[model samples]
Target: MRENTAEESARLQSAAKDHLWLHFTQHGTYNDDVDIPMIVRGEGINLFDDRGKKYIDGLGGLFTSQVGHGRTELGQAAAEQAAKLEFMPLWSYAHPAAVQLAERIAGYAPGDLNRVFFTNSGSESVETAWKLAKKYFKLTGKPGKHKVISRSTAYHGTTHGALSITGIAGLKQDFEPLVPSTIQVSNTNAYRAKELTAGAIDVTDEQSLERFGLWAADQIALAIENAGPDTVAAVYLEPVQNAGGCFPPPPGYFQRVREICDQYDVLLVSDEVICAFGRLGEMFGATHFDYQPDIITTAKGITSGYSPLGAVIATDRIMEPFLTPGAMFGHGYTFGGHPVSAAVALKNLDIFEEENLLEHVRSNAQTFRSTLEKLLDLPIVGDVRGEGYFYGIELVKDRATKESFTAEESKTLLHGFISNKLFEEGLYCRADDRGDPVIQLSPPLIAGPADFAEIEQILRNVLSQASAKL
Candidate 1:
């Protein structure tokens, strides 16, 4: 590994401090005492900082890098496409790469979800989904159905419509009086089942969990009824809820939600921004969960983070009204389906097939779960829950009582100690305090038992020290 010179490092740090405003980051905290971290390179499932120190890419570059890193094939594909056609809009004109990629995605999507609308990012995809839902309902003569339903502590995106659907209050408080008529119901955080269920039912055993799952699913139905079904256009959900940690759906959760949506004449949208592209050991999370959604909004791993791209895949039923002559959905991102991104995604999907990445993740998921479950021996680890390559280890103040950290404690624990400690110990995962104090892990699909061990060891050390601090 090549190291940076003192002057070069200082210059980079200076430039970052002067102008680089990070997303969802507290920029003011970076001072002389607290220097900014600069990741200069990545290869395989590891990242290198400006100082050339290597750390495992445990979060898969914000749950995006599915094929790991440093694959010249993806780079070459991007370069070739860029050389041929650098930029093009998806407005009125269609490109070959986009058409091929769209057809491929449609083929993979379940049911009649064969129509694809490309977007620039996950947020745009979500925005498009909501807009499409409203427009679709209007054209289908359900014009009153303009509202959306999502889960509490869920994160959709940062845009106006996406942020409106996002269930995290703190994230939307500043941006509020947001796009109106969005409602939030309970999430399937089975670990917190007792609290979520208001102690109405036991959640200790498998049978009880099933009951909890049904109850959670019923909340969406109740929300729809309360809002009046005619006013509810769609329900947006992630197969495994991302914010507030990876909350996987309980058994029959999606199935029940699907039934409720169908009964209410509402759309079920699987927001796979972070769960798609083999992250959950399947092409789409809905496939892994065995439910068919009316629409699937995806991005992140589409190009393995080689480029920015997202798409909303809708079923035939939803696309029927829009197919009429002179009827149109007035939504399109300028770089929605860039040729280079589409090319990179096509190549990324090829890598997924050529490498059998999906099967690999499926075969290794249990081992990954067991490896991370080892952390439960630590007093701070309240729960380790998720599916496929996605998991979240929730930190608590007292494991026996399932007590969580106070806001100040969470701030100090997550940001001051845990986040920095894990990175300093050479692991690039998330110590998120968005909903709860939890360490989120979604390594590259290529990561196996060996990488899991490295992640376990690093997290073990950092979390042990964190527990000691507490």
Candidate 2:
């Protein structure tokens, strides 16, 4: 499927408008008649562009294209590990596809997570799990336990120590003097849990949403007793907290946040960088919420995005003070665990175990959540929440007084009209206004139910024409 050329699409949109600089772009919303997006190719869950057009990859590419996107067997397992050992680097050396993909991601991690470390993204596996939780409390002596905690709008990445454990104060207020002792708290947005309990719980009672998930998991034991649990070491979360959208985890939130980080000896971590490998049909969204963390971090679908990788893993009592003998945690990452991104993450986890694809996202996660809760009979769809095949809808204006939308009306309804009307109606998702003006969807855990009825009929005709323009 090649051969589409308007003089090679005006010389690749004139070398991406004279040199592209995208990431988190605004880029003056592209100039010479707005071009940029580009894309080029992809397969299974679709994609294409550069004149070929197609689309429907509805966010899996950002939520790293699971087993989708033209899987030429993960590019022939990165060209047979770049013809056997292409750039090995897990410093002090190691290879054989990064020691068999870190013993197969420590046998699919959970309890006794069994070390791993590697990194290259997911903000260098959350800046190497906050520098291995401040050097595992300075090699087990608790050298004033290097403070950290996280929640509010969540996110956890964009480097500077995962952007000071990111809680989204406008994406770290223009990266301000960061890398300080972090802290944030209160996230389990059980539909804003009665405005985070100011109305003292009862967001439509299921025993007041399990007492608002045990007061949002006792706010990380009240931020480790107001930062004095030996100056706290770690907390960082996200086994389903992506930004402020896909917020799941409420009822008994992460088992009361693993009993308040095991009664405040802190260190829980589990960032899952977009809910780990299966995007929540559990490979580890902390065992799809059964809880047991210590450190997980991860990267966008391991090698599903074919090459770059990331990890952290931990446990085995946080790698027992870096395996003693002349101990060291003085981090690393010159393409951490490279060897062709650990042989394309051990052949993208052997195509998620020969395409069981985590039981095809656990048997179609409740038909992708009742087909996105049938767009909540739209009035700008106040909430649809999320879980497997990760979701989120939010968008409001008054779905019976849930109100929302005014940061200039959610920047004119999610960036001036529902993200260019759901990519000019072909579907590549996410209209995220960071927190509230949601949309999100995370397609391609080999999306089914006819791709969730063509993503709920293109989000019910662009949210019923964005609820008739409010």
Candidate 3:
């Protein structure tokens, strides 16, 4: 990695501060004193900033880089595809790259999820899924079924339809009067089982955990009944909910949710934007969790973040109505399946198989979990939850009582300190308070035991400092 020249760095800083509008960013934080973090290059599991400082990519580049970074093959694939066929729309015609990539995804997706609809991002995939669900019902004579049910704090996407299905109120309050009839249900966060279930289940034992799982799954059924099943079109869920700090579903949770969806004629959508493509030690999170979904919305690792692409994989039954003569679902994106992106995705999947990345994750996931669990010895560490390479270490003010920080404390501790301190220490991970203050880690699937040790050490140092301040 080459360091940016002083003049080049100044130009970049000026252009960024003046012209660049970062997503979900607070631009006010940047100035002469506070420089914007400018990542200039990546190789393997590490990233190099403009200043040439190397840091381990603990979040897998926002949980998108499954095969790690700086894979020239992916870029070459994109170039070759762009040279052959630069632009084509899926509106009325298809290209070879899109067709091939869709077929490959269908092969990897679980159950009868064989129909692929492409988009440019996770939010678009989610929006596509909701529209498909509604259209499917309308075509099947249940036009009234347009409502969706999702878990509390589970983030689906940022587009209006996907945002409506999203359960985070903070992210939605600013964009009021969203799509109507999206209901919230209890999530399977076992650590918060006592609070989620109102003291009915504490999750002290396997039996109690199973009971809590059933209770949480039952919440969807209750939501459906309350929302009027006739008006419910689908229930969207993540295999492991991401927003509330990587809450893995309790055992038998998805099975029960599957049953509920089937009983109510509701489509089960597995939003795998962040969990697909070996992130959870499987091709799809649904496969890892052992459940069938009527639709699966995914992106992120599809092209390993080398290019933007997203997809909504639907079951054959969901596509049956639209397959009729002259019948159209009436939805499409201009860059839904860009040839270059599809080619990149195809190449990315090839790397996954060639390197046995999924197998690598499965073999090393336990080691990663145990390494992160070592943080429980810290006073501020309350719970460590998640599956595969994705995990979240929840920080509490009091470990014994599991008392989380107040909003101001969370802002001051996480945003004000831990986030930047972790980066200064050369480990790039997320310090999020979307649900509670947690250090979210979703390293690349290719990461091994050595990488986990490094991650744990950095986290230990920064979190120890944070605890002292608290």
| Full-model lDDT for every candidate | 0.93, 0.84, 0.93
Candidate 3 stretches with Cα past 4 Å from truth are: none
Cα lDDT tens digits, model 2, 117-181, are 88887888888888788888888898899888888888887878888888888888887999888
* Model 1 per-residue lDDT tens digits across residues 50-116: 8889999999999999999899999999999999998889899989999999999998988899999
The model with the greater lDDT, 2 or 3, is 3
Q: Give the clash total for candidate 1.
A: 0
Q: How close is candidate 1 to the true structure, as a TM-score?
A: 0.99
Give me the overall lDDT of model 1: 0.93
Candidate 3, pairs of clashing residues? none
Best by lDDT: 1
TM-scores for every candidate against the unseen true structure: 0.99, 0.39, 0.99
RMSD versus native structure for model 1: 0.9
- Tens-place lDDT per residue, model 3, 132-159, is 9889999999999999999999998888
Error at 181, model 2, angstroms: 20
**Clash-forming residue pairs, model 1:** none
- Give per-model CA RMSD: 0.9, 18.3, 0.8
Q: Which ten residues in a row have the lowest lDDT in candidate 3?
A: 1-10
